[model samples]
Structures are given as structure tokens and as C-alpha cells.
Target: MTANRVLYLLGSAAPPVLNIAGVIERAQAADWDVCLGLTPTAARWLDDELPALEELTGHPVRSQYKLPREPDVWPPADVAVVAPATFNTINQWALGITDKFVVGFVAEAIGKGIPIVTMPCVNAAYVRHTQFDASIATLRVMGVHVLYGDGGFVPNEPGQGRPNGYPWHLALDAATSALTRRDAGRE
Candidate 1:
């Protein structure tokens, strides 16, 4: 576990984001103090379940930046996992665009030396876009553990996404490995 054991479990508006509750539960089972954050679209998708998610995590499900002078809602994170990271999120994050709360936090986290794990849920069609590969490479070069392609999330054909088959465990395992690596570096 990380020194803080605080996990910022951020998700984007992919189909896999719908099963986030179960992922949160699994993270909790691993003894992580999970803080949930969502992209705006993802937040809207889970609007009705936001309260329950907040209750489950014992922290707010923040999708927007807090106003200046407002107290921060979630605890500081020891590690961050961006699963089902949408195509937009991946590109924006790599380009240092932090308009959205979830992307903002993770982008800043990189400079703060917070270990991060991200798995993109982009469809094969979207992966063909020119920016996608560059973005993915940029993130990896920044020391983010990107679980993509083989040994991680492989994009399915467009319109053929299987929400349940997004390989949640790989992202969780990558998070665990990231924390472990951080701890080892300290020793």
C-alpha cells in the first residue's frame, strides 16, 4: 500500500464507467481509501448514482473544480487510477489541457510525482485517429503507467464494446504495482 493508501479512482464517459461501483468496492477491499472523480460526461451518466457513490467512498464525487477559497473535498491522493479513460481525456491530458476536474488533477499529479495508472477504453476506430498514438506515447514518456494494447486494454471494434470486459483488474493491478514501485524507491 502507498504511504497514504488514498486512491483517486477517476473515470471518463466510456461504457465501463457504468460499472465503477463494483471497481470501487474492489479497490476498497484492497484497503485503498478510494476517492471518486468523474469527467463531466461521466458524471452526467451517473447522476442518479452520485449520492450513493459519495456515501460508499465517504467522500464527494467531484466532477468540477472547486471555486477559489472553497475547501477541497477529497483527501490527498497517494496514487491515481484513470480507467476507462476516454479518447478525449487521453488526448487532453497528454496535451496538458485541464479543463475538467478529473483530467486537471491527474495532469498536475504527474508533476507532483504521484504515481498514476491509466487505461484507455477507446474503440479501435478512435485509436486510428492520428492524435491517439502520440497522446499515448506522450503519457508513457511522462512516466504514467499506461495499460494499453497487449497486456492491458485492447480496443474493441466500434459498436462492439463489452463493458464488463474492459479488464478492470489490470488497471487495479497496475495501480498496486505503481504504489509498490514508489515504496521501493523510497527504501
Candidate 2:
């Protein structure tokens, strides 16, 4: 991977979003030019850090749709990683509900054939809801690399969530692998 590779690291309002700065640094170290996008709530959560985050990525951290007249803000994404995807975000994405900027971009990325990797941060109780599993299945059917179950996110109990333990690496690895496979296909 070269520094020219652009990574769209889209985040939802999960506890792990707090660790985004560190994750961005890791991605940069791995040779990706990262662009950060956040859900509205996640943006608020990191409001105090937005300027620093933009300075770090060298791109604006966007949380809403740009005006139609506005030029594109960042380079095109070679891959996208949706980490700490929350229960609401997952369902909305699977159902084609593009109300939020993060979900909208990812949902469209599917049709654009942009490789996507996502790791849910929901709890065991939330997974028990019928819609949760169904949504995950739907995303997989639509070509999103959902990092759940055995090798990926295993839901913890609701009140007992571990923010620091979220596997950021899994989503990052999957994203880079997608880019690798894509590059291979070009040969």
C-alpha cells in the first residue's frame, strides 16, 4: 500500500469513536491517507477534538452532506471501514435508510462497489432483537464485509461494554485486504 491510498474511516456513536485519533494514526502509519467521517452524535462526542482531527488527517471531518454546490472535500476512497457501528446505524443502513451522513455514504458505496468493512459495537441484548441479525445478514448479502461473530465482534452484556477492547484492527485489516484484492484484480 502506498500513501496515495485513501481510506474513508466512517464512525458511529459508539464508545470506540473516542479512540478514533489513535486509529487514524495507525492507518496513516500503514500508508493510508485517511479521511474521517462521523455520525451526528459521534461528531458531537468529538466536537472538542474536530480541529485537531482535521489537522491530523489533513482533511475536513464531515458529519453532514455537503451542499450540492460544494466541491468534493476529500479524495475518493479506495476502501471504507465502519467501526463501532451502533445498533441503529446497522439497521438503518441495511434497510436503505440514509438519514444519517455516515449511513448514506456507506449505503451508496455498496452500489458503487467500493469495498466496505464494518464491526458492530452493540451488546448481547441488542443482538437478541430479531432485526439485528437480519440486518447483519442483509449487509453481507450486499457485499459489505461484516466483521461479526467468531473472528470479529462478539457482543458483550449491555451494561458491561468494553470501549477500549473494541477490535479496531479487524476492521482495518479487512479494509486493507479489500484494497489488496482490488489491486490484484487490476493485474
Candidate 3:
């Protein structure tokens, strides 16, 4: 199977709220299979873009999981991205709680050695919390790439792209560069 399949786990963080498009665009350029894994909270913000994304990627966008109908038709993702990850989700996943399908999928991915990337978009208050720090440390130890969100640096104002601040495209570029390097060594 091609290793392009990606499970994008969404969170309620604001910056990731804006960076999802850039991430998806980058993933597509890298020939990745992008799947939208929305948390219950994320569903609220997905607004009208979810269906279009499903159509564009040609993969089912899922926030929940059912029994694998055919062993291959389920929530199996090669790479998983939890962007704008909330501390709640982080804590739950670290502790092995899968109440939400998104959390469940992440839990399973970690157990199976799937590469999972997490971009946390939280205020300074939550970011500095001790429990949040502990969760981040645990996730890193478990091989999850934790991407810190834009704090004071708002890429874009409300309802706009990061006009003047640090563009999220930079992150996408780095991710692609890393992939290119990995592929180069293989060749």
C-alpha cells in the first residue's frame, strides 16, 4: 500500500483552525492520502468545508469509527495529524481514553507505531499548565510530532489569512522538506 494516507485529527484550537488548508495542500503535493479526522469540537467549526474536502481527497471524512466492514475499509491511516490539538484530547489520548472516535483512532495509531503529528493551538494559560506539559512530554516520547501553534503571532486576523505575521506556509514547507530528505536518503 502507498504510504500517502494521512489521518488529520482536528481540534478546537484557533490557529489550526486556519492552518488546516495549508497543511492539506502540502499533504496533497506530497502525494499523500488525506483523511479528515474531526473531533466533536472540530465538527462545529468544519462548517461547510468538510464535504468539499471529502470530495477533493476522495476519502471518507470521519470523526467516529465503526467496525471495519471489510478489514480494509475503516479508520486505518498511515500518518495521523492532530492539529490545533486541545489539551483535553492530548490528555485523553495519552491516558488511553477513546471516548471520541478521533481520540480512539489516535490511541490505536500510537499503539501500532503510526507516525502522528500534533499541532497544539492553545492560549498561554493552557500552554503553561503543568498537566499540559506532562501530556506533551508523553506524546513526544511516544513518537508524536508536536507542533506548537501561533500564540501572539496571529498568522491571519479573524476571517483572514496570516496577512502580516508568520505565514503558516513555512510550517508546510518544513514538513515537505523533511519528507523530501527522507525520500532522498531512500533513493
Candidate number with greatest TM-score: 2
- The lDDT of each candidate is 0.94, 0.95, 0.62
lDDT of 1 at 13: 98
Predictions: Cα RMSD each = 1.7, 1.2, 4.8
Write model 3 residue lDDT over 1-187, tens digit each, in one string.
Answer: 3545454535453545644655676677766666766776676677678777677667666666666673544445655666656668888887888889888877887778666666555555665668887887898888776665432222223355232243345444444544455457679
- TM-score, one value per model: 0.97, 0.98, 0.72
lDDT of 2 by residue, 1-187 (tens): 4589999999999999999999999999999999999999999999999999999999999999999999999999999999889999999999999988999999999999899999999999999999999999999999999999999999999799899999998888998899999899989
Best by lDDT: 2
- Model 1: clashing residue pairs? none
Off by over 4 Å in 2: none
Cα lDDT of model 1 by residue, 1-187, tens digit: 4435989999999999999999999999898999999999999999999999999899999999999999988788889999889999999999999999999999999999999999999999999999999999999999999999999999999999899988999999888889999999999
Q: Between the candidate structures 1 and 2, which one is better when assessed by TM-score?
A: 2
Error of 3 at 111 (Å): 1.6
Global local distance difference test of model 2? 0.95
Q: Whose lDDT is higher: candidate 2's or candidate 3's?
A: 2
Query: Candidate 2, residue 11: CA error in Å?
Result: 0.4
